[model samples]
Target: MSPTHTDVPMAPAELDPCGMPDHPDCGIRDVLDRVGDKWSVLVVVELASGPRRFGELQRAVDGISQRMLTLTVRRLERDGLVTRTVYPTVPAQVDYRLTDTGASLTHLVKALADWSLRHREAIAASRHLYDQTHPDHDIR
Candidate 1:
């Protein structure tokens, strides 16, 4: 007789002995990596206001390179988080806006930003103290 669903063993890649995902590039990790990227976070925040052109995003994101911004937007597009609209003007303008899914994520992102702002001073002070005590491992 064929094994039942419950009789089948879980794939090794699905979980480790500790019941955690075994693969480094698991779905959750992949999503987290994209969402947690600095450029992606900033791009998402900027798009939260409304649709914006490429140049506007470049300017708004502060230090992102043209190439980096291009990659970030493409990744967001592929992930269904942003939509790119092309306007057939003389210069062929392109604008990016958050999709519904992306918009939903903005609330969580904003909360995280708010939390960072609230704790930044304490975090900085802790970092400074740590750096002072561990001069050999000082990051600054």
Candidate 2:
């Protein structure tokens, strides 16, 4: 059987006595640096339901370009957040599943998704107000 979600292992670290990371450039930011890319987060969230084939993932991730998705999945796999499997069919097919470590992140991704949904209206209103006040600025 595949490992359960709770078996996901937390990254071991060398932290200071203050329960902080020892490196000057360490801390949550370091993690964000790895998984913070929007595509990576989306991929994790997408794989939460179960393993998905490459095309399914690309479709489910919405506007992500194929190249971007490939890079994102590769990065996540490199970081031990995902596992890729290839089937030896007449036309070999590949699928990606979250490792135990990656499964642990699903809840956080869900929370983030929930928060975004809840705040969508407020965010749009805020953007409208900002645009009205700064019509001369390029919002993009």
Candidate 3:
């Protein structure tokens, strides 16, 4: 039998891992890739409370380098998930906030955060077991 259009082998949906047929062109993967990094998630959560200036955000998301923060913000801005506003002043103030779409993703992000909190002990245990097994390997 010949392959029907629906039966033809198609590529895995690049955008979403869910592979739903309806969202053929969804940019969800690109969006996830952009925001999947740790610093991005931290920035999003920090901005969820309210808009923050660059330096303030840098301070709030501890351990993030200036370069990484700048890169993460730029990626979020380019993906339309975050908004950046600049004010003309002697100090040249700039602020970042989440877009509506980004706001919608907060539930998912929080769910992940909740899971992380719940599993921290288990994760630590697993890390301890692995470290014992691999001796000399630093799994930080």
Score every model by TM-score.
Answer: 0.81, 0.79, 0.75
lDDT of 1 by residue, 73-137 (tens): 98888788999999989888899999999999999999999999999999999998998889899
CA lDDT of 109 in candidate 1? Answer: 92
On the 0 to 100 scale, the lDDT of residue 14 in model 1 is: 34
lDDT score, candidate 1? 0.85
Off by over 4 Å in 1: 1-26, 138-140
Ten contiguous residues with the weakest lDDT in model 1: 8-17
Maximum-TM-score candidate: 1
Ten-residue region with minimum lDDT total, candidate 2: 1-10
Compared with the true structure, model 1 gives a TM-score of: 0.81
Please tell me which model should have the higher lDDT, number 2 or number 3.
Answer: 2
- The residue-by-residue lDDT of candidate 3 on 67-101, one tens digit each, is 77877887778667899999999788899999998
Candidate 1 local lDDT, residue 99: 98
Q: Candidate 3 local accuracy as lDDT?
A: 0.82
Alpha carbon lDDT of residue 31, candidate 3?
62
Candidates in order have lDDT scores of: 0.85, 0.83, 0.82
When 1 and 2 are scored with TM-score, the better candidate is: 1
lDDT of 2 by residue, 1-140 (tens): 33342233445554223335565644556667767788999899889999999999999999998777877887788778999999999799999999999999999889988999999999999999999999999866
